[model samples]
Target: MTKKSTIKVEEVNNQIVDWLKSYAGHSKVNGFVIGISGGIDSAVTSTLCAQTGLQVLCVEMPIHQATSHVTRGREHIEQLKKRFPNVSSVEANLTSVFDTFITTVPNNVDAGKVNLALANTRARLRMTTLYYFASVHGLLVAGTGNKVEDFGVGFYTKYGDGGVDLSPIADLLKSEVFLLGHFLAVPQSILKAAPTDGLFGDDRTDEDQLGASYDELEWAMSQAEIHKSSLDFTGREKVVFEIYTRLNAVNQHKMLPIPVCRIKK
Candidate 1:
């Protein structure tokens, strides 16, 4: 696999920043609200929104299981505030909310399903908070999904992390996000930190669930894209076939809206 040195760092950063500014203006959102999980994706999102001169609110929501993550999240937010003095910070403890809801559910469900449901609930709660603040503060919920997560695997929770007014990095690969971070001069600590969802027990990293590295996934996606455009299916056919097959099979839901019918006029 190719290493990080192959990509043009400066060009990606400039393009991303320019696109972010243009989208914010076009959307006419008064500002942006971003959930900062002490992870690179959210950190990058918050930084770019703040740099765009948008009124940014960095929210830290921690359940009992996520206390340490919250502390790290706050530190990153502080770093962002130092760079962009206009940013604001807020804390909302979600422990009680999660506890109450989980306790109400029966324990007979599969452990994996129950865990996923709980994690998804936490994500939706964060979105609810973002929308509530946005409504009162007249801001848009800024999304933090990178292309590798959002497109290649459909890794986001619908109506949860997926509930965004506008996504600035929707087209960026995971590798590109890091390059942009370097350009923004984001703290080395945050840049090097392992990526996590912070929904399960502590130290639960995203890569643990994906079963593959971002570099491999991205290369697969590129090959799949080329195959779609040309339909040759010649060299590298096996790899390209596997990539598209997995993406289509796993991300079927992303291709469809919540199933509903429009009343015929």
Candidate 2:
């Protein structure tokens, strides 16, 4: 069962918009820059940034991306532009760049590790692109990570999708992001599409990589918070809890601050 936050959408929406406006105002930046991935998280995040009525740059960094993802991303960008005058978009096709990088790197390892490394490379390249735009425009790179992925399972790249100037929706879960997305009137194509990182250039979903759905992971997260043990669960629930715990442990490096070696002197 998917557990959704009981947060009041309208109230939370207003709070986030106000918060974004305040943060940008204090930081003396123009606005936000977000990578549109045709997924609910980005759609909702960009919309929230738009609600601030500040400059919001929706960037498309596609590197051998799936057709559906590109289409949905373009659709959402168009819809957002129509609704907000402060919204603008740019597409940075990185296919050739990715191909060049692949050739430059040594791939003596097996195909599996090579593919995984390249996928992460795609994310890092996009991160660099976003920061490039942000630097040029004097805007903040807004992150699209939600609570489940950012906190519970740590399902984001280290400095890739994980890199950002600010996280506007990091407190919300995947389900809560959908709720906010629905309230924000994000494009239906994005709302209905399967969640993907678009890093692998294939149709494989976040679930395919994570071994559990967002809903199941959300449930497991809640159970863990209550100090529940694997013995408390049975069947698929038990399996999911184990999966969530394993990932949460291994990916703590991603979630926590970078460890600095301290001097005992």
Candidate 1 local lDDT, 1-265, one digit each (tens): 4325356767766666677778778877777899888778898888888877778998887776565566668788888888887799888878898888878989687998888888889889888988988888888898999987787778788888899988888888888888888877777777887778887756867767765567767766776655654245545545544654576567768746777888999
Residue 31 accuracy (lDDT) in model 2 = 98
- TM-score for each model: 0.86, 0.98
Estimate candidate 2's RMSD in Å: 0.9
Runs of candidate 2 exceeding 4 Å displacement: none
Whole-model lDDT per candidate: 0.78, 0.93
Tens digits of per-residue lDDT for model 2, 1-265: 5676898999999999999999999999999999999999999999999999999999999999899999999999999999999999999999999999989989999999999999999999999999999999999999999999999999998899999989989999888888988999988888888899988888899999999999999999999988557888889999999999999999999998999999999
Candidate 1 residues lying further than 4 Å off, grouped into runs, are 3-15, 65-68, 226-244, 262-265
Index of the highest-TM-score prediction = 2
